[model samples]
Each structure stands twice: as structure tokens, then as C-alpha cells.
Target chain A: MIALDDTDRAILRELTHDAGQGAGALGRVVGLSQPATWRRIKRLTEAGVIAGKRLDLDLEALGLGVTVFLGVKLALRGRTALGDVERALAAIPEVQTVEHVLGLYDYRLRVVARDIADFERILRRRIMTLPGVGEVEANVLLSEERLGGPIG
Target chain B: MLDDIDRRILRNLQGDPDLASADLATRVGTSSAVAWRRVQRMKDAGVIRATRADINWSALGYSVEVSLRITLEKTAANAFDEVMAERARSPRCWKSRRFWAVSICV
Candidate 1:
């Protein structure tokens, strides 16, 4: 693991907030020259600490107004079943994130849809049809607070 | 109210928010000035919230991550608000979401 100093942490925090800021502006925030800050950012990128910059889209404005967390328990407990289910889940466009977890459920999924009816359709038609899928619990997200990361 | 060009620009930006205005314009088949204006308009309309650094928490020495589902008592009228307020005050609570009846802390 690459060791991070206070300056590196500061740069990360600043970038986490507004990554579109110019390197010179970032430098001003982190108390460094433009080239110096650029080098640090480059290093961080090379080290895979800063994965990439992503646009935070307002999904509500895009008409995707519903977010649901689903806990899926598979009936079969074999590796082949797991692979099949995972592959099938990945193909659905609305399935934002899929996590294989060791807990009450085998998989957890973050799904987005245009509305409640849309979500129900996706869940019944797309999700329930997956191989070895048995029990499913879904929680519809009412509101969310995106606290970026623990970098400050 | 996004046109084809606007959608194209947004798709590219979502993939790589650091794309220069000129490069983005080239990819979207528009003038740099037009691309900048469209992006500005989207930002103003709240379609584009912010460009954020996607940090790799595992690479940053945060190896273990947990998702906890907490259910609060429905008897309390202000239970949800109180719990949400408390979570907001905690720095370690990275992302918190209130579902229909459950609160997910990650």
C-alpha cells in the first residue's frame, strides 16, 4: 500500500468534492504549486487511489425516480448456480450494483427504475426469472445522503 | 429535455468527467462553445450535479466494508428523523439511505 501524507489526504479530499476543478485551483486549495499538485494527482492516479472522475447525474431528473435494495437468496448452493445468477443479474440495465455477500442473503442488488410500477415489472419479470432464485426481499429507498467517502 | 447531442455529451461525461471541453465537443460532434454551454445548462438544471473523484477505498487501506440494516421503532413519531439526524452527525457514516421501513448504513 502506498503511504499517504497529510498533503495527499488533503488533495484527495478536495478532489472528492469537486474533481472538475482545474489543477491550479486544486493546488490553491491544497497549498501547492500547479505542477506540484499535478504530480501528486498523477501519482495517485498511477497508484489506483484515484480511480477516475465520474459525473454525478441526477437520476430523478433523468426519470429514474426509484431506488430499491434487494436481498436475493438462491435456492441452489453450487458454484455453477452462483455464476449463472450473477451473469444473468449483470445483463439487466436497471441493476446498478450487485454484491455477493455472506449473510442472510446470497446477493444484494441496487436497482433503479422510473417508478414503483416500473420497479415491480423489473422485479417480477427480470429478477424473479433468474436461475436458482428463491426468496427475495426488497426495500424501496425513500431518500439518500451521499457522503462521498471517509476522506476528510 | 435532453437532445441526442446532449445525451451523447452526458454519456461521455458520465464515463469520464475529466474530458476536456474541446475533446468532449469532438466526440459529441459539436463546437467546443456549444458543448460548454450545454454542460453549463445541465449543471444549472441539476441534471449534472458534480464531477466527483471515484476513490478506491480498498486501495486506500480500507479493506473491510460493511452494510448494516437497521429497523427503528414505528411507535415513535420522530424516530426516523431522529435516527437520520444522528447519522448525519457521524463522519464515518459514508452513505445512509432510508428505505420504506429500514435504514441502510454503509
Candidate 2:
């Protein structure tokens, strides 16, 4: 088992805010050499704390014009529905994230599209195809005062 | 090659990665040379990918957030490939955060 100390967490937080920072820059903040920082990052990746480096891009640049959240409810007998649900959603370009959640809702989706009609086509055709999916509710995100703001 | 001073340096950087090294060293109570070397070494390793990020929404002229859930059957590998491809086509799919843990006594 691997236990991350306070120092390790500090490094992670720094990376989260700005993943583009180089190890040399990170070392100055985290107190390691470029090599040592590299090693620690590799270890973190192996340990699952650090998944992978990603670039936060401009959404509109890719032609996704609207953002919305969808709450999906499925029948209790839908354990078998997982297969159809995943495959169908995977084909929608506007859908960015899929969350399996607990509560009255079974799943939540973050979607981006040019407009509501685009969302309707995907929802009616792909998402509703699941055998157990019963209720699908959507809340369009009008303005995000804080996008990707730090949690905790 | 890290002591108490080095840890202090790292802490400062974590809060604000945009600070200059010489300025950062001054705040960490160390000389510029030591700070520069430490930073230089960290860069040689992949511990840090970069330090500059321009995140100005006003300049970009757009806003977005997208979330979706995908349940897959068959080979988990094939499903994952499809999901990744979907993510790649959409710019809003960036910043994927996930948590998974497994424990075993070997």
C-alpha cells in the first residue's frame, strides 16, 4: 500500500490547477529535483492518484454550442440495460461525461451541442433506447459563474 | 536532495505556480541559485509537465460544461475505446476526473 504524505497532496493540487507546469517548475514548488519529481509523478500514476495529463480546451472551438445536464432514471430490473446504455451513449459527440449516481436518478450526463434539437435527436434515439430507461430530465446550463472551480 | 528549505519552496510553488523562480526563492528564504537548480532538476523529470496556462474565458468567447454516463458490455476494452473516441471528438470532454481503488493483502 502507498500512503501519500502532505507533500504529495500539495503537488497534486498544484498540478490540478495547471497541468502544463513542467517537473522543473513543480520541483521548485514541491521540493524535488526534476528527476525526483518525475519519479513521484510516475509513482502517483501507478498508484491511480494521478490518472493522466489532459488539456482543458475551448468548447465552442469544436462547435459544441450548448451545455446541459441530464438526469436519467431506469427501472430496477435494468441491470441488464447497462450494455445498451453505454454503447448508445458512447456514440453521441455532444455527451461529455456519464456518471452512475445513487438517488432517484440512476445516471447523470453532461452534454454539449449546437442547440436543443441536436440534444433531442440523441436523447430520443440513443439514450431512450435502453430497455429500463424510464425518465430522462435535462437542465440546460445557462451560465457557469465558476467552471471547473476547485471542489473542497 | 531535499531538506526543510526545499519543502518550504515547494509549498510556495503549489499555491502559485506562475511566480518567478528568483522571486519564489526570496519568499522561501533561500538563494536564487539553489531555487533555480531545484526547479531545473524537477523539470528534467516528468514530475511537472508545464507551468503556464491561459484560462481567460472572456478572450475565448465561449462557455461550456458537459457530462454523460456510458454503460458498456462485451469486452471492457472495446467499450473504453469507444468512450475515449467520443471524448476526443468533443472539446468539452476535457478535465476528466475519476476515482477507483482496490485493496488486497499479498
- Kindly list the per-residue Cα lDDT of model 2 for residues A21-134, writing each as its tens digit: 678998899888988888887777666655454434344543466677777776554465676676666567667778777665677778888676886777677677656777
Candidate 1, residue B96: Cα displacement in angstroms equals 1.0
TM-score of each: 0.86, 0.51
- Model 1, B1-106: lDDT tens digits are 9899999999898778878899999999999999999999999999999898888888888888889888898799999889888887776678888788443222
DockQ, all candidates in order: 0.51, 0.04
> Lowest-scoring 10 consecutive residues by lDDT in candidate 2 chain A?
A143-152
lDDT of 1 by residue, A117-150 (tens): 9988998899987768877888999888777456
Residue A96 lDDT in candidate 2: 79
State how far residue B59 of model 2 sits from its true place (Å).
Answer: 37
Highest-TM-score candidate: 1
Instruction: Tell me how candidate 1 scores on lDDT.
Output: 0.87
